[model samples]
Target: MIENPGILFSVLAFLCAIGPLVFIHEMGHYTAGRFFGIKADAFSIGFGREIAGWTDRLGTRWKIGWLPLGGYVKFAGDMNPAGVPDAAWLALPAAERERTFQAKPLWQRAIVVAAGPFVNLALAVLILAGFAYAYGVDRTPPVIDQVAAGTPAAAAGLAPGDRIVAIDGVAMATFSDLAKFALIRPGQAVAVTVQRDDRRQAMPLTIGTVRQRDRFGNEYRIGRLGIAGGKPVYAPVSLIEAPLAGVRATAEIVSGTVETLGQIISGRRSIDELGGPIRIAKVSGEQMSLGWPAFVWLLALLSINLGFINLLPVPLLDGGHLLFYAVEAVRRRPLEPQAQEWAFRGGLAAVLLLMLVVTFNDLGAVGVWQRLAGLIG
Candidate 1:
């Protein structure tokens, strides 16, 4: 029933985009397992039916699956369903059990599980560095690019030709600086300085409240300044500088993600804005049509996200398992079987709930909900 080329392209893009990243992520586990003297039974990319596969001398089956959503690495003597406890594994004798993930030292297991996310983070940094190196950084100068007619800026006598010299007598070096003055402190009246034909003029301006939409259909409040500023051009720098640029961008992205999460928790952000697989497909398809640069940028951003999500302290996640292992290490014993089972059930429920929420948000954003409502109307 998939007729649209855009949908098809989106599917392909999702596979192409997520497959390598997932493969690399799982590979991190596989390689770390090997390093920790654990034996991997199977390494698969994607899920469900195996489309193609080959086995290595070590008896590890490398495979491509029909469902390209995600992937996994199965280590020998591990519990079924990954990281579970197995009676057979326990019965397999100490030497064999040592190959199990739980049987290894806590530090070793943590490294193996943590490697996937770590690789993703590293890839993000590298991609960011590469991007900064290719394109010189851009910043908006304090000069107004355009002013909306009848808006606050225009009403306050701000003009397109005006160059912002300062705000409240604080010398403004760039247009972005002036913008931040408006954005972070919305609804506050502030003094503005401008250069009019070599003469400095001052005026009072107030920030306006605006609605911003996320990947999901929900909206959030942001400060709006009705003027545009031109980005100051910076020449591309040396390789060294490129990595520094990468660090700056990546740090900002991480910080933004954290801040957004905090806002959502505090009710300042809407949960309806959460995106799911459908949204990702749409984005992937759109990016593919846009060009490779945009696609690559999305990939890097998603990679960083994937890395961050995996590190959350939730059961069934890498971080969660690492946390349990840390506790086990500290206690010198594993947690009770019932406790582990309960933790897993809770984790599974949380994940399913998240999935449902995101699916609903995606459907709404894609106009499915709106179309149905229109039909009813």
Candidate 2:
């Protein structure tokens, strides 16, 4: 029997973390649709059987479901949560079609579809900005204070007192910037520019890779540059500056995600590194145990990731809808309904495959496969 309080807490924390994010994402779609005079049939916080629900004056059924995995806003004419237009509704009289999502102008429909992911992105930015305003921004200079022997820094002939000014021609304004750039590019070669005394020189080196475990025993393989920087420094950010700081932080996260995905696509990184709901739940619980601050930070990070993922050009995702809209705009007509149906089917299969792969990776991460092997042996 599982008796660990921590395990239970992790499950609760996972719900606490994901539930609101999903609600907010669905709310974004709901609100945007309403703004354009489109009627929604349902605003559901999960899929499958309804746990509880009530109908609002607008006749929208607001409900919670047992699954708690994700949520969706079902527009008046949607055939399902994926928002495919119902052929029956499409054939309805023009007067009845006015309030349907399909009846909206192309631009309005695009906005409604795009709003969900953009709202997630905006939420992340706001949360980060709040943090910056409450605390401050890191202002540590990118000067190398020590270069560990036999490491990448040493191999590249980098020395103490050399200041990192750029990596691959991109400016590094702070030590944090340097770390962020290198962290996602494990074992990747890069050109590092540094200023030693009065002369600036560029050196080529491969970032070292290291396997490390977090406090909760979660393992990660990350880039390591075996160099130390000077003492930490932080500067207070004003309310006006906080938003900018948040934007910069969000941009960094986006770039890092893109870089990591690119590496994974190119087979430079192991597929095992990909994580799913299980990994997220584990991390969420760990972060919650740390403190509210840590948990909140994780929330913001995950929110940004949620937003970014929805923007990808995959069918059944917000991006996929946008892609169809883009094609519709260019073609001066919608694609054949048959083609769209097939595309959605393909997308659904791809999405399901991804979920399975990530879940398998998550199981491996939690030692489920190892335990099964031991039992079999």
Candidate 3:
């Protein structure tokens, strides 16, 4: 048995979580480019100096780099991983230019770039489908199992057998919907409709608010009706329906992420909730300890987030490349080389800055900085 198993588990779990997703993303670019008859000069996992590499018959260099956080595909005629064209590319012979990525038709380029994020989404759907096919999902129905005394549910005359049908006229499908509805509207008044003995009745109730603390001592305010769900029911779904369920599940994650981001941006939520690599690693280990199934679910969620982030219209990302192509199509020409260079530089700076900030937050969350400060003191 290993001492400090949590540290070991976190490291391994983080790698397992990131490795497959990165490969899927980069392989998407490589596969799509080759399919379009564009030659790939190199494909690498990670950045910096190459640790190991091999060249194939097609002259594509496949390599693993020192860093393992992400990867990229270098299409022929690209100056770097950003897919910018070089002077050598522009001066190539006509036949050679044909094999280069930039020389391809606009639609093909877009497909090659968009393929990475698309594969990520597809991978998420497939992973989720597999899980659904195997064990289905555990869910709590809208029927109230317990109404805590002195809470909104008890005051509103909600009983143990009552089934919540709607909140403010919005039909709720599950117990989760009830929680979701109340959590964001702390201290607000809302009408909840319930079905009892096949008769529906609406009850106006005030959402109770409470300050909750995490193990890390971070505080948050949330609303509650103070009702608990009964035992979770696991529905065994067929394979055919699994993929459809996967689609729905993936969409829910995306929508929830977008909503959270919107809340943070609108100042309705705190930015402190944003996490980085360390937080992910910690969560990965915690999930792995739960079960392999839970770990797989974490990977699926991470895959979806990877796809979403890469699709942002910021330079140095797949979405940024697509943005450039869109502008080219509209303006009937590519942006000036200098302009493109400066844009990529700015994007790199922005990405690096974000990484630094997130890393700092992670350090703070894990008490690394505080511990060091104590030592110094």
Better of 2 and 3 by lDDT: 2
lDDT of 3 at 47: 85
Provide the clashing-pair count of each candidate structure.
5, 0, 0
lDDT of 3: 0.86
Pairs in clash, predicted candidate 1: 139-231, 139-232, 140-231, 141-175, 142-175
- Cα lDDT tens digits, model 1, 161-185, are 7998887777777676676556544
TM-score list, all predictions: 0.80, 0.96, 0.86
lDDT of 2: 0.89
For candidate 2, lDDT tens digit of each residue in 124-166? 9999999999989999999999899989999999999999999
Tell me the tens digit of each residue's lDDT in model 3 across 1-377: 22233777888989888888999999999999999999998899888999999999999999999888899888878865456578777899999899999889889999999999999999999998888888876567999999999999899999999999998997888888788878766777889999999799999999999889754344567889999998877789898999997887898778778877787788866666677888888777777876788798899999999999999899999889899999999999888877888889999999998898788878887789989999999
> Which one wins by TM-score: 1 or 2?
2
lDDT of each: 0.80, 0.89, 0.86
Task: Please identify which of the two predictions, 1 or 3, would achieve the higher lDDT against the true structure.
Answer: 3
- Using lDDT as the yardstick, the better of models 1 and 2 is 2
What lDDT score is found at residue 142 in candidate 2? 97
